[model samples]
Target: MVERRILIIDDEADIREVAQLSLEISNDWEVLTASSGKEGLKMAVAHRPDAILLDVMMPDMDGPTTWENLQQDPTTKDIPVIFLTAKVQAAEQRRYAQLGITAVLTKPFDPLTLADHIVQTLKWV
Candidate 1:
């Protein structure tokens, strides 16, 4: 079976490291990471990973805005995005849904189950 690639876009180095280690160790996945939206966009355009795990809050461009930009570009629009965030308020989730975001995982997540959550949300076998 071919392994799927995952791009993680987060401003927090610690979170990116933890997620990379956890996902790479737990599944047959190739992980790429970026510390900011700009770098992430570059990597996304260059590599076109199977999926993206984007952080909702960042310095210059937030996840939703980044997602919009990705959608605008034909190269990255088809890639699935799962937002990883600390905010779990009902109103916030509703807003994300309104923005066409269907998958989200709250921060401080269990690294062991994170990959599983993503796969299930994306309906990947």
Candidate 2:
């Protein structure tokens, strides 16, 4: 099977690295990471990843803003986005939904289950 591509957008280096490692070790996935929304957008256009895992907050451009920009670009609009954020309030979740996010995964997530969570959320099982 061809490895699925997943783009991770987050300001935290550790989080991005950990997620990349977790998914790579557990499954056949091509992981790409960006440290900022700007970089993420650029990468999204070029790579056309199968899925995007975005952080809610970051310096410069936040996840929502980045998501908006991605959606505006025809090249990446159809790609699914899942918010991997620490902002886990009911209202915050609603806000993510308002942005048309496919799913939201909270911070401090279990590395072992992370890929499964994403698969479940995306209904790829």
Candidate 3:
């Protein structure tokens, strides 16, 4: 199977570590992490990863804004993005869905099941 590259953008170090390790081990995928939205944006453009897992809150350029910037960039516009957020309220979910993201994975997620969730959501098998 071809190894998929997943980029994780979050301000939290532990969260990034958990996600990177989980995806790498569970799916044998290449995982890249950025601790800020600005850094993440640069990495996304340079790496052109298969998908991006973005956190909803950050110090600069929150998730929605980051997504908008990504959409505006020709190089990153087509890359799929999945939001990882703690905001799991119904209205919030609806709002996120309206952004046309590939999917949203709530925080406090199971590391063991994260890859599976991504696969099922993205139909990556």
Candidate 4:
């Protein structure tokens, strides 16, 4: 299988580390991490990963705003974004659907199944 590169944008250091490790080990995906949306954007443009795992809630330039910026930029607009939020609200889920994101996955996820979630969500199988 072709190796996939994923950019993980989250504010928490531990969360980023765990997710990075999980994806790398499970799928052999190249993982890049950023602590905030700003840094994530720059990395997204420079690296142009296969997909992005964005956190919903963040300190500055939250996930939605960052997604918007990504859409605006020609270089990053085509990259698929998957929301990785802790909140599993139906209202937000509907909103996410309307926004045209790839998918939304909740936090506190099983590390073992994280790659499976991505694969199924992206229809990689």
Candidate 5:
């Protein structure tokens, strides 16, 4: 199988670490992490990962704003993005979906099941 590259963008160090370890161990996927939206956008453009897991609430640049920027950039616009957020209200989910994200994974997620969630959501397997 081809190794997948996933970029995780979140301000929390613990969240980034957990996501990286989860994806790496469960899916054998190469994972890149960024602490802020600006850094994440830079990495997304530079690496062009297969998918980006972005945190909704972030300082300097929120996920929605960052996603808009990504959509404007030709190099990163086509890459799929999945929102990782604590906000799971029906209205908010609808809002996120309207933004054209591939999917949204709620916070306090199961580390072991994260890869499976992504795969099922994206139909990667």
Candidate 6:
């Protein structure tokens, strides 16, 4: 199996920790984390993880804006991103679908199955 490198950007400490542990243990993924979007942007540029799990709601910079910043940069634009969000309303889903992201994974995700969900969503082998 190709070991995936994943970067998780979430404002919540618990969310970041749980996701890092989940990806690391479940899929043997190399997990890097950042607590905010600004830090996440720097990490994304420097580390260049295979994929980024981005939290949709953050104080300084929200996920869509962060994704846009990622897109504008040549170095990180092509990396696939999955948005982790709690806004599951139809309007929110439609808006996310319009963002051209690979997938939208919900918040309060199952720790055990997160790797599987990501693998399935991204078609990672």
lDDT of each: 0.92, 0.93, 0.94, 0.93, 0.93, 0.93
* Root-mean-square deviation (CA) per prediction: 0.9, 1.0, 0.8, 0.8, 0.7, 0.7
**lDDT (C-alpha) at residue 111 in model 2:** 91
What TM-score against the true fold does each predicted structure earn?
Answer: 0.96, 0.96, 0.97, 0.97, 0.97, 0.97
Which 10-residue span in candidate 1 carries the lowest summed lDDT? 95-104
Error of 1 at 66 (Å): 0.7
Mind giving the per-residue lDDT tens digits that candidate 1 earns over 10-117?
Answer: 999999999999989989689999999999999999999999999999999999999999989999999999899999999989988888775888998999998889
lDDT of 2 by residue, 25-54 (tens): 998699999999999999999999999999
Query: Which is the better candidate, 1 or 2, if ranked by lDDT?
Result: 2
* Error in Å for residue 37 of model 4: 0.5
* Model 6: worst 10 consecutive residues (lDDT sum): 92-101
- How do the residues 1-125 of candidate 6 rate in per-residue lDDT, one tens digit apiece? 78989999999999999999998988888999999999999999999999999999999899999999999999999999999999889898888889888888998999999999999988886
How many backbone collisions does model 6 have?
A: 0
Which runs in model 5 stand beyond 4 Å of their true positions?
A: none
For residue 106, model 4's alpha carbon misses the true position, in angstroms, by 0.6
- Name the regions of candidate 3 deviating beyond 4 angstroms: none
Tens-digit lDDT track for model 3 on 3-115? 99999999999999999999999889999999999999999999999999999999869999999999999999999999999989999888888998889999989999999
Q: Which stretches of candidate 4 lie over 4 Å from their true place?
A: none
**Pairs that collide, model 5:** none
Task: Write out the backbone clash pairs for model 1.
Answer: none
